[model samples]
Target: MTKLQPYEKRPYRPGVGMLLVNDGDLVFVGRRIDQRAEAWQMPQGGIDEGEDARTAAMRELEEEIGTAKAEIVAESRDWIYYDLPPDIADKVWKGQYRGQKQKWFLLRFRGQDSDIRLDTKHQEFDAWRWVPLDQVPALIVPFKQVLYRKVVQEFAPLLARA
Candidate 1:
């Protein structure tokens, strides 16, 4: 069995979020800036020294996707975590939290697709689209695919009920 990486016991590690939805037939997803780099990830970032998780989630959503005031209809009771790739982990953390322990929030899009922004203000996602949620597992980076599977499985019932 693969042992999970030990997390640093801290107040907060800066992080971001991915807000997904069930629009009858599709799920909203975004692509990162460079396909060549592993930068293509769900909106996420580090938490400010005094930032709360929920507030930070909202701030990041706006900064990264130009989304503001989204209703967090659902969220995971637990925080899903992943280890940093050895190449960048040491430099990324720089004596902070060893890894991110993310609280995944599933939000319902309250506005139109045009609201998403990929510009100088927040260039987290260069592009966005709605795709079959089932296919997300295949599109994301391999390391994150495992956590994505679990998130989808846990939230499957919610989508079905919608």
Candidate 2:
């Protein structure tokens, strides 16, 4: 009989995040449907059992933003991690994970803005917009600001040539 670790000692949830960039070099962000404050984020979600991170990223992008019309430009050299605030750690992910370890993909958008649909069967966002890469860190929740900044920094060069 194995015992479970405390949530604080639990492993981070494995996840995938997408940095969808337009031809103009702006990144896509969406206002969270679950948050009341002005919190926005790039498309991201958990990796399903047996699914690879790249597949999960594309699936999450379509599920969250209703479009997968993007091509991968680059992948982060290493996984990035962030911890959930103590107050919310036990509330999210059924108290199983303390945070997320994410593989981020830089994808170039291949469709027009009109192609982005938010009214998916399971909607994650209420509104969406394109913003410069540097503005991403400020648009997300405070807890995720550092993660966003790291993502931006990692992908900035690829985004410039994209």
TM-score of each: 0.79, 0.95
lDDT of each: 0.67, 0.91
- Location of the lowest summed lDDT over 10 successive residues in candidate 2: 1-10
lDDT of 1 by residue, 18-100 (tens): 55674563666778775676434556666788888778777877887777646776777788887655544545556344556
The top-ranked prediction according to lDDT is 2
RMSD of 2: 2.1
Error of 1 at 96 (Å): 4.3
Instruction: Note the clash tally of each candidate.
Output: 8, 0
How displaced is residue 99 in candidate 1, in Å?
2.5
lDDT of 2 at 156: 93
C-alpha lDDT of candidate 1 relative to the true structure: 0.67
- Residue ranges of candidate 2 with Cα displaced over 4 Å: 1-5
